[model samples]
Target: MNLLLIAALIITSIAVLAYIGSMVLQSWLYSVPADKMPLRSFVTALLAGGFLTLWCWIDTKNPGRYDTLFSFSSYDTEDFDVVDAVKKVGEEEKTIRYTRRSVGTKMVYMNDQNQPFRKADAEGAIFALIVTEKDKPVRFITKLDKNGNFPPGEIQYREEGGKRYIDDTMIGRVNRPGTLKVIYVLLLNFGHFLIWTLSLWLVMNYALGHAISIACCLWLVITLLIMPVLFTKTRKQEKVITPQVSFPSVNDPNLSEPEPKDEEKKGTRQFQDSNGNGIAILWIGSAISNS
Candidate 1:
């Protein structure tokens, strides 16, 4: 199989396994309801798959952009004088020395005259290295120690038998440069992964809601399950309590109770006509009784 394909397969397999393990752990630790397990697994797989797909697409479109974004240059010990090395920004040059600046934070470049350059000029050189002169491998002269020994942060090349090889540690430094560079690469990839995962989840959630199937519902349940499981406590499942409703029979005493009538006025009786219109009639007691 092609190396890139093999790498992709390995990465995807690891992602799937990691996702499954996380879900299993969460379910076991938090006692995630059985009904929600399938959905959670599906969502995890979807997110992992989507991120991997996006990464693969980007990698396919531009082969080495991802690697170059985080890569640094390596140098041999004899090409330039370490003590006299200077960082050139515009027309001004500042001497390079060990200082408090974080490692890999400084962008270093060599001009056609074999000089160190930085800032805008260095950036232009980097662009050319990544684009125009990509066919050529870029390397640099390493800085030496006080005892003329190969020092940290410098990758040295050596010749053995009729072949040239780099020391193991030196190869690592060449590939990774510094702690900060590794961290930067990690954070960049993580940011991309998060963005793609969330976007895919949202679109899938919306589409699944409309479709409405056992799988879709399970996915929704798992989606709901994540927030509460990761960030908050799992809510106690409440038992469905059916309210007991009782109706009074016609023979019950409560039902037989007559409603109280309004007290009659001393000299007026309220009457309703045949048309159901109510009117107040002025009358004496005997006349009211007769009416």
Candidate 2:
């Protein structure tokens, strides 16, 4: 079962990667103009978004199947209660108690010395056969689930005295590594972010055709309006047009104003003869006379 599950996961991962790779290749080959690229990229991102959504859904549906292992913790304690009972055989007597804790599909029990003994379910009902180690090193007889859950049914074990035994499995075990759990959580969050951003892009693309172009224009205008306010140093410095006034110095030998040129005289005469306002001519005459 573990092999089959691992194979399925490997196949799924490969298929997803292959599909994403094909889309990326297509995107590179069919590169479009900036105006149209957002939609294309959005489409590619949508595929990833869908995959993420499905992945999250699967993880949620199966509870601890993908992200973690299933065990007694998987079930709510409120649903089941543990009871203690004593049993006496024809020649001996022993006390047994059902445990609330479980490791994978096996039930955990405490011996008279408080040593833990695990029992695997043989079939549909619980069995008396138990596995325990009192004076030897712990040995695992069954593999843990990828998420760290225990397998169901019977487990084969060998005693310290070289005696072999088969016991019924009772509870599931979960042995998922911390690193894998962290990676899965991070991937889930990243996928959600990607999906959200790309989904917005897709909606904008369809609802507002040429959304990219419009966004660019808005961005340009906003930058132009905001830059000067944000960075006062970047504000355009206005040129100061200072009027030059010349005054004759008291110590100067030549104090006479320069005479008007022929073009200025002609412009003044023309301005006077045209029956128009002579304000322009007066200004020109004054400037020429001053020069």
lDDT of 2: 0.41
- Give each model's whole-structure lDDT: 0.38, 0.41
What TM-score would every model get versus the actual structure? 0.25, 0.25
As for model 1, its CA RMSD to the true structure in angstroms is: 26.3
The superposed Cα distance between candidate 2 and the true structure at residue 147, in angstroms, equals 38
Q: Which stretches of candidate 1 lie over 4 Å from their true place?
A: 1-23, 68-188, 192-291
Top model number, lDDT: 2
Candidate 2, residue 186: Cα displacement in angstroms equals: 23
What local lDDT score does residue 161 receive in model 1, on the 0 to 100 scale?
24
